[model samples]
Target: SSFPAVLTCKAAVAWGPGQPLVIEEVEVSPPQPMEIRVKVVSTSLCRSDLSAWETQAIFPRIFGHEASGVVESVGPGVTEFSEGDHVLTLFTGECKTCRHCTSGKSNMCQVLGLERKGVMHSDQKTRFSIKGKPIYHYCAVSSFSEYTVVHSGCAVKVSLAVPLEKICLLSCGVAAGLGAAWNVADISEGSTVVIYGLGTVGLSVAQGAKVRGASKIIGVDINPEKSEIAKTFGITHFVNPKECSESIQQVINRITDGGADYAFECIGDTGMITTALQSCCQGWGLTVTLGVPKVNPELTAHYGILLSGRTLRGSLFGGWKPKSDLPSLVDMYTKKEIQIDEYITHNISFEDINQAFTLMKEGKCLRCVIHL
Candidate 1:
């Protein structure tokens, strides 16, 4: 029996930071042990992808992680997924055997955790190459190409009944927001929740809060235009920081009659983390930070913030173990318990990939789905 041959396919390669992606033919090697090769059907642009494309030094890389695809082939010693299985690519994978994975308290899988060096966890090597020159992968999924190879733990098998294009959002943004609200914060009914940022992730948080029966879900974003669209996702109020005369935190405190019960920092700005904390009530107030900061990773807060009984927490991928948790999210989408299609503001082709970045930077779209 012969293995699948190396595949030469179209991939959007970024040669330098802030440079437009070049669509070129690249060789995708067969999956190594504990890996799988996938035919990506749909991929979406994420803020983290944009941040990496603009700032991260890892260039000449393939940038994409939120995606849905079908398994083209499975590598040796892998039995969880088979060829032709529909799946969603996960940036942070769940190697169920790890301590954190089995603890039932964390979604961070130590073995297949976040890959920052643009290579596979099993080996510090890339599967994508152009004329024998390596092209780094973005978050291991690299769905910007027509085909990509990912560790089996980094991919979740989903039902064929779900639309590959829409369900792809669950691979990252939507799931993150939903998980932050439900798992991390455990938002209670009738509580006052304020979310800083109204991107897909923030809106998903709003939706989760609404589903949890929160009485007031306030969405804070600089863009006033997002207010109308955000209402559909359960946001009861919208605040534009630029328009407010007083501090945004003051405004939130006024509306909530002291402070909101929960505040979420979803804008990826470390500066906003403090504001989120300030907007929370004194006792039992929880602030959850979901953003990936571009710089100034260090966080500073007045000692009184903690002394006053307020808690600050961090959320990654909405506390979801991709392989073990994403399937239930897929089910929630199918049952209309969640909103995936509402977040897709634009659908573009692979050739127009750069346009998606523009829309994201300009804050013109919620999510741009790229058909591969």
Candidate 2:
């Protein structure tokens, strides 16, 4: 696959907070060394991209992180991947030199310049332009458009046999959810697991616990319809707060016999974080936080929860090391070991991006994918 030196591509632009994503024609660059220019075939909406504004990210943002595409071009020094290869982009690049990476946690790549405002790649600018004005890729891979450029480390090669449409999910929600349980918390066999917010991430956690041989998998969700697929994914107990006999915590306790051995808060809501902690039992339940709160300043609950051996922790990209985990995740998908389709409820064209965002806001779509 070859790429044009300069191409006009369709993209979603966020002018400011509380504004709708606008579709525009943005200029894309050919790949740079160790970089791969991808012709994105599919991209998915994620709350993290919307939550970036809380960090004070600049306006006119080019959002959308979970995406997949075909490698159009590779710059000098690139060898592992080539044109025509299917790949998914990771916003968090694997910087092996960083302590986080050296610690074998590539998911939390310490090299992410997320907080460095108005900064672009080493090229001094971005691969996008609007009316001759510049725009930056929201994450290293802004696949909201028809095409985008990303770092080599950010591009994870996938099984060629896997459809690019399905592989797009391995880039974000699917990876994050499974990673939280499989990598971060390490759900053990016969463990009692409780998952809050049965959206994509929460469900992924449930599947992880199931795959780990968890005997009791409890799902907690405010939406009654959320648990519709819970049992299919190995969830043994479903407690919709609306139908529960007691407080959310009590139901978890009653179901687990004392409390859950492991719990995951997939909803970034602060209130739910507290509930997630209290729902755990004595000294073994590990709670993983995979959601990004919309509120300003990273939220935290009462410090006492940390004293109960009810460990409270967070994970980025489910602690994924792109080069290693992405491929393995793709393998999992190929083998049908994990559930990715349950997350995507809708598919839209690139021009209907705002509609996708609207669906995401309404909670009508777990992942409204945009096909290029």
Candidate 3:
């Protein structure tokens, strides 16, 4: 299939660190071998996207991870996807030939090295440019742009029965939370589950626990306003850290009769890592940290916590093999087995993306979807 030498499109570009994204015209090169060009239909702002923007670590890049779109063109050697196929963008790529992928224990395949470098895995070069200046790709799937070229491994075809706006949440937040409970934590039926942070990811955790038939689903957040909405996602009890006279962990300990069988920290705060671990039962309690910490903050906790039979684990995309597991999750959403509409608090055009960040910072929204 022949494609244009360069496709001109609108994109929210980060020209420099900490600078607000400017919606402007940019040039996207056609996909190379093993790559596919996608026209992003809808996307959502993820907390991690904000973290990356604030850190100013990778400037001059298009930043967006959670998205749904359609294939516009296929590069040479790309037979899995064709033009017009509905798909979701994956921040984490799955090259089934890699050792990690073949092991079935991890999704962090070898292509991650190139992705970390903000370049195409086949060739260490970016596909985006503004007036000839290079614009790095963020998370391998820069859905902030109207058009993006990604490796074939980063695009997963999904059924067109669902809307791109709704299914986009499954690209990251939905999959991460649900996978954390079912795949990583392996929450058993009738178990006590505690979730920290009541944002979209945290709420999704509560839903996962509910699906697992948890006896108790406890949600903890400093904001009292989140309590009511948390309950809608299967949270049995809500704990506001600010209202508690005692420490948050102490409050959870009292509520769970020792500690919760499974605990999750959905907000990426290094301090919360210790608190989440402490909120677990001394014997056989497991805690998973799903939040992405900022600027390599060192995590610390008392040794006694680990010695008491508690486990602290970290989840990347909820340990999902994107190409293999994410499709099933999309199917679950289409079947109404999962909730997506309740999480969307605001929907705005791609140009007003800066406001989405502000809404997230003020804790006023579950998720802000950007229509491209």
| Candidate 3 local lDDT, residue 322 | 89
Tell me the whole-model lDDT of each prediction, alpha carbons only: 0.94, 0.78, 0.89
For every model shown, what is its TM-score relative to the native structure? 0.99, 0.91, 0.97
**Candidate 3 lDDT (Cα, 0 to 1):** 0.89
- Each candidate's root-mean-square deviation in Å? 0.7, 2.5, 1.3
| Per-residue lDDT value at 264 in model 1 | 95
Q: In each prediction, how many residue pairs overlap at the backbone (N, C-alpha, C within less than 3 A)? A: 0, 0, 0
Residue 97 miss distance in model 1 (angstroms): 0.5
Cα lDDT of model 1 by residue, 160-279, tens digit: 889999999999999999999999999999999999999999999999999999999999999988999999999999999999999999999999999999999989999999999999
Better of 1 and 2 by TM-score: 1
lDDT (Cα, tens digit) per residue for candidate 2, span 1-372? 343487787788777776877888888877777787888999888877756633445766687788889988787778877889888888777756778778854456666423234334556567778887878667667777888888787777877789888778778788888888888988889888998887777888887888889989888877776666677777788888887667999888887888888888888887787888888887877778888776643565777777777788877778878766688888878888777887778989878777877776677778888888
Instruction: Report the C-alpha lDDT of model 3 over 1-372, residue by residue, as the tens digit.
Output: 456478999999987766889998999999899999999999999998888888756668899989999999988898999999999988988899888989978878886522666767777889999899989888888889999998999889998887999999998898899989999999999999999999999999999999999999999998889988898999999998889889988988898899999999998888887898898999899999888877657899999999999999887898999898888887888789999989999999988999998999889999999999
